[model samples]
Target: MTPLITDPLQPVFVIAGAAFCVCLMATICSPALTLFSQILASAQKKVFYDKFARQLATMATTLGVLCFTTMAAGILHTALEEPALFEGPLRLPLMAALGTLTLAFALQVIYSLTWNSLKKNKALHRLFGLFAGLSMFTAVFLSLGLKRTVLAAGLSIPSSAPALDTFLAVYSIPAQSVFWPLLAQALLAGTGAAGALGLCYLLLRREADNYGRDYYNFSTAYCARCALIPSLLQTIPAALLLWMSQPVLSPFALENPFVLLWAAGIAIPLLACAGWMIVAVSAAPLRHKPAMITAPVLLVAGYAVQMFAALRVYALI
Candidate 1:
């Protein structure tokens, strides 16, 4: 069938699915990286790195399972609805992929638990990561493929796709016409993005050690500052897009496609540039032993953006 995304509800599926996939990718790949780092550390006879790697592997695995569960739940929830949470030729394929991801995540969790029970070593962690990687890769691919088509059908995506004209057309409204519910949805979602970014940062030091790469070492001192780099890179755009689109702005804006497109188009590059600059600064060569001081400052800045956007949206609503 021609994979045409038409329903207004399609954006929800697109956004949720994409978010799940991205989170899943991080969860899966992180463990493998952790395991690899452990091996590197072991070869160098570095106990600290090795221990950190083991802990990271376990944490990554556990978190992966949680993210997978959340994504799976989202997919299942969308799939089982009567009229269908979304309609498109790709829907079935997307559902099937999500189902597969769910199974992969479940299996990885089981494998990690078993490995942890058996022993604590690079081998066990590596094995678990290998399994998770398979699922993560699949989720990432599916998400990338479905993103534009899904959003074009009126779904949410990172503001990276071609401008969404038709979708915006449906939600067109004067700024003054926006309403409470619309603002609430935008604010809540944006706030969620900000919160998620914060959590991701707090866990970064542990996660980077999992990679056990020279870069990982380079990243350590900056951990305090660079911790939220990845999550911030991911979240800022989504939050801004939500703010600009004002889908909940009002009945009129909710039905206009142009505003949605404008929001997304503008937010994408801005966030990307901002994320890169922050990460670059954080990753810069420095002799700081503890990452605490710089990291906190950067994190606060990132979180502030999210908080401000959410509040602004709320006020508008």
Candidate 2:
């Protein structure tokens, strides 16, 4: 029932963590969408490559830089505030997380900047984008594992091992029960958020760019499906995550109205957003403008609430 974070700087850390999550998800999704667009273009499909995919790549680079900076700043802040967290068993995993993120950011920038030059080498260019996404996903897994190791009690870190074995041990931590569900939940949520954001971006630009009705309609439908499918699929992992945390949360469940409210805050808006997106995709082109606009707003709001609630629960645990 009591608040977990009493520190005066707790608010600042929460804001920073939220910002990092948003930026990281956007970064991951942008590159993935870019790869999807490129595949469509390569197949001689009717995609607007320059306006849609290239723009997504650019956004990916920008968001990657932002995500990297935010993560670095967070690590530095943590090191300053709690130096012991970086000591002993925790050090290697944290380092690996940062190193992987750095690699992802570098690859993302190259992929974006070389898009034009790589026209003749589409395969290699796609590889760069692919690796960048993979790296980001890996980083997320490592970071999540490290977070669980830090928070959960009675997690043992192998000691007195050789350097290589130690590194492997740290990397393998996510395979344990505590971290995998969180990683799955994050990937699903990030994919859904990316799709929702893409839908909003397309809607905002559709008027000014005035791509033909057919193209605009296709793009809208694409983004809508992207947003809807993963979101619906996310429920399984979400339930698993909640189940995993029940031990920590059960004592307060009945006493805490806010917990239930936050849960509703996450689920209701996203379900409504998914319903609206269905309407947008099914209705006549641009006829359901309100649905198109409202879906993304609700999606983002739901995600924000979910992130806030998850952070609070993690702190409590």
Candidate 3:
């Protein structure tokens, strides 16, 4: 087997998968982000939730569209390369994932286009985002299920288990228990990125006298609180994934196809550091520390996780 990792077109997989990862994060976080932005008032802060919502919607929609198209192409290419990979019972799950993705794209487009025009109808706009978010969540849940099954197929696990039993067997019981939390990791990553960036913007606004220190502090604490628990809880699912997938993945390479695991290792601590600084800066009343120190680290590490996960999904080095 030629290492698919080294294929010339692997970069295409990287780019497409990277975009898709962002799409997943954005889609999952869109509703919360939109609502969070709305709760923040310009009078009390330097940012306008509607403006932030617009930017987020634009990003999510554009990426969602690209992901929808690119994944379609990528799937076709991979299926053609290895027809058996998609045959038998596997097609059902893959098709479900694809169908979910296609529907998400349409919802995203409609949501994005209506952003400006639907200013008066905030409820409907939010409704679109909410549906899209749920759809995106469903799509990702199905996709993760598919990845486990794919790994099982790649490892050629032999068993007399029922059709779906092979998948459950490969993915693991304890690991599956943390399914929603594992999924929430993406949401945490998304919120961390948005909150950290928004914090920076607000800090800059404070220096510019556009926003008050109190508002900045409040917002910092708010964002940190939103991300901290999920970041902490992610350790469970991360460990589960590493443990469960190791036996299946170890045969594929020498020492390193688990870049996603490595990235998660780096991120978990950075997230802790960032969370602490954010707390000191925003949550701590006695003494506020410099949040700027850890914020960038968190963003970079979070992005690394996202990037590594994309690479793993595409089997790209």
Candidate 4:
């Protein structure tokens, strides 16, 4: 089977897409962590804000900008390359995605910029963070639906009858079958990225900021624990996605050496990172400095391998 993309720019798009995914996930998850800190560690809210949430908010803002820029560029590229793609049932969803993304970005900026001013009003500020995360998740949901619509188009599936039906279809079971698994994978991947990034940030600041070992310990443990839940649970969705893909790629997966390599590439680092995180969280004083440094590198490697493998598979199909 021929690949889906034949353009010379395919590599660029793939890289950009992967980066955009990471940025979007970070954008969504950062604020979520902020909200979690606000709610769960309310007593330590000041320390959390000073040490973690504040920086996370800034990172989320920067990532939100990158996500918006990349998404807009992608949309424009698609519109220019294949105008007909937007003329079909995907138009509504596309519009919804753009709107949601814009709203998310705006909310993120407001949430970040108002941090100092809103310090006195924690309730309102947390609401802003919560809404920002929700809007970003909605954008992701609509984008995924748009992707499914494009795939359905390729398969010659008919568009829904009602003008709004396609938009609403995402709420149905069949749509959810696709959505849920992807969502799980995303949460797993996103939180992994978040944890890795958080750890890296802490490592960089540890010496220069002189925040004290106690602060670093708490932050490191916090980030690892946040990522731990998703890392452990990711197998369920990973298995589900594999099961779903079997009908299409079963033979390819079994026969192709590269597939096996890529699968291993995805699993091993993730497991190692998860195991390291467990150790980091369980140990007194959170001692794994090397793991803190390497976690982000491992995550990027995993994402890179996953993207390459996916692109290769798409090419063959």
Candidate 5:
């Protein structure tokens, strides 16, 4: 008999499979959904963000489906093989992560639907981002810790050629040796955490400064939906890198430290730069046409790359 989550590879694989479906759904429907929402609100005569309430609603529905699938698989894993999976210290954290993720996604769905209805509720919007950040942070810690514990235990060692294949079959991702550069990754996390907090400040600043006006300039629905995309985008990469590097604490993909120097040292910083560019572009007076087009294009491209990387690492591609 298989130990539900005991087959560490199995549960991760299940999660990845569900995520694959979500990616397809997001890619195929997100644009269409956004367009539909705009059409529905054509008569609203609101700002661009306000008019996107329906788009957020659509995003919430799609993401809700994704989160539900993930939770269902996790619950089933826990329920079917409770004794094996629940006997250890890791059990509680695992369950906690799953539950939080479920609640976050569920709230996301509701938040998405009612953003327009709750447009003035800045406090609530901040709470949503708070929960989202909490969820991602907890998830990163627990899931990566669990994966590290398993790897260190030598429970899933390979003894054959095609080592990458062996690793994926048992670990549910491509072979990634990551135990050496722990400090760098930790620094990355620190940077990322700061960036995350900075974004939260950006989101909340409008409300805090505005006397009685809405804190979030956008409709509640649109803001809620928009909130999710960034959270999910950041979490997935962070989780994956964290998981991959647990074994050795180094960059997972590149063998040469120099290579890592470029990937983590250079690429990540560039991505950060790009993020700030978007922020500044969004706030620019007059909103230059080049910035307008470049910002969204960059964001969409970045998200697409992140999603594709997730799929590949998880072997969903």
Candidate 6:
């Protein structure tokens, strides 16, 4: 009698959403960091920023489209799996989430489309870019909050709970506790994701005739620096995520070998990849591939492990 979405393909959808979330956050944050990098950057560094900043914005906008689409589909699947949870007071949060998503999308689109054209009004353009990132954060925050509520409604409380709303309200206290962990992962992992992507792009262009050797070195260093911190911090939050889950100790979920296998088969390699990225990037201005280009492997593993684990925690399996 399992719901189709929850038991069958839900993991797939959630994993896809996570991947996009990582990409979107990374891309969105990159340009903002680039903007901030300007103040402290040398004249030579500033020139590099000026050339690539707009391209980052464009990439962010494109990634946002994929992020939102996958997220929307995930939401729909979750809603269909548990229709009752989305009905009452929860609807308010859902609507707010949609509102924030729409606003964020509009802002990002404008920011992307007008990147070069809006340079005439520097302050306004910067404001648009800044707000676009914030709006995205807000949207993700609200959506994840509601999702946690729905998940708790299904997995945490007794079936005889007075009302789903009340269960959600009370459950939210514990649920909200995980927000920091979630946010930390998104931001840090996003940065690492973006940095990894930047490395790939820079490595590809390292020998190109158009850009000077100095710019290449500068960009390689910058991207390496950006990738380093996130790679360092990401593992901590990821390790703590299950412990932070509301009602984390379900009888159904206890002592599951899948979790262990996932840890061994997936998380280990992911950590290795993260570590490799750090070491590779640390040796910055790398003219050739560093760390074996494991991003594709990590991406697939990330999608699978996250999807499988979430489904298990949510009792979707």
lDDT of each: 0.45, 0.68, 0.57, 0.68, 0.41, 0.61
List, residue by residue over 1-317, the lDDT tens digit for candidate 3: 32434566655655555444644564556556755565564345645445555555665565556655676787889899988756654656677778887787688778779877987887788788778777766777777766755654355644444657654554453545435555666666655444444444445445654445565555556555554544555555555545544444545344454544444553554655555454745444214335544554554555455445444544545
Name the runs in model 5 displaced over 4 angstroms.
Answer: 1-46, 52-57, 74-78, 154-317
Candidate ranking under TM-score, highest first, comes to 4, 2, 6, 3, 1, 5
Ranking by lDDT: 2, 4, 6, 3, 1, 5
Instruction: Give stretches of model 2 more than 4 Å off.
Output: 1-16, 49-51, 79-87, 155-163, 173-178, 204-213, 251-259, 283-297, 307-317
Model 4 is weakest, by summed lDDT over 10 consecutive residues, at 153-162
lDDT of 6 by residue, 8-117 (tens): 56566666666665576776566555455443343554667754555455556676777778768977898899786566555566777788878878887887687578
For model 2, residues 1-317, the per-residue Cα lDDT tens digits are 55645676765665555546655777775677778778887687555754567666765676667666766787789899999766765677778888887888888899999888998898999999899889888888887766766666676765555646666665566344746766776787677667666666777666777887877676666666766777677766766666666665655474664466456645854664556466555856456667666665565556555555666776641
- Single out the weakest 10-residue window by summed lDDT for candidate 2: 169-178
Give the TM-score of each candidate: 0.45, 0.80, 0.60, 0.82, 0.41, 0.71
The global Cα lDDT (0 to 1) of model 4 is 0.68
> What tens digits encode model 4's per-residue C-alpha lDDT throughout 85-106?
6777656777888898789889
State how far residue 216 of model 2 sits from its true place (Å).
Answer: 2.4
RMSD of every candidate to native, in Å, equals 12.9, 3.7, 7.5, 3.8, 13.5, 5.9
The regions of model 4 sitting more than 4 angstroms off are: 1-16, 43-46, 80-88, 153-162, 170-176, 206-210, 252-259, 271-275, 282-287, 310-317
Greater-lDDT candidate between 3 and 4:
4
Q: Give the TM-score of candidate 1.
A: 0.45
> What TM-score would you give candidate 6 relative to the actual structure?
0.71
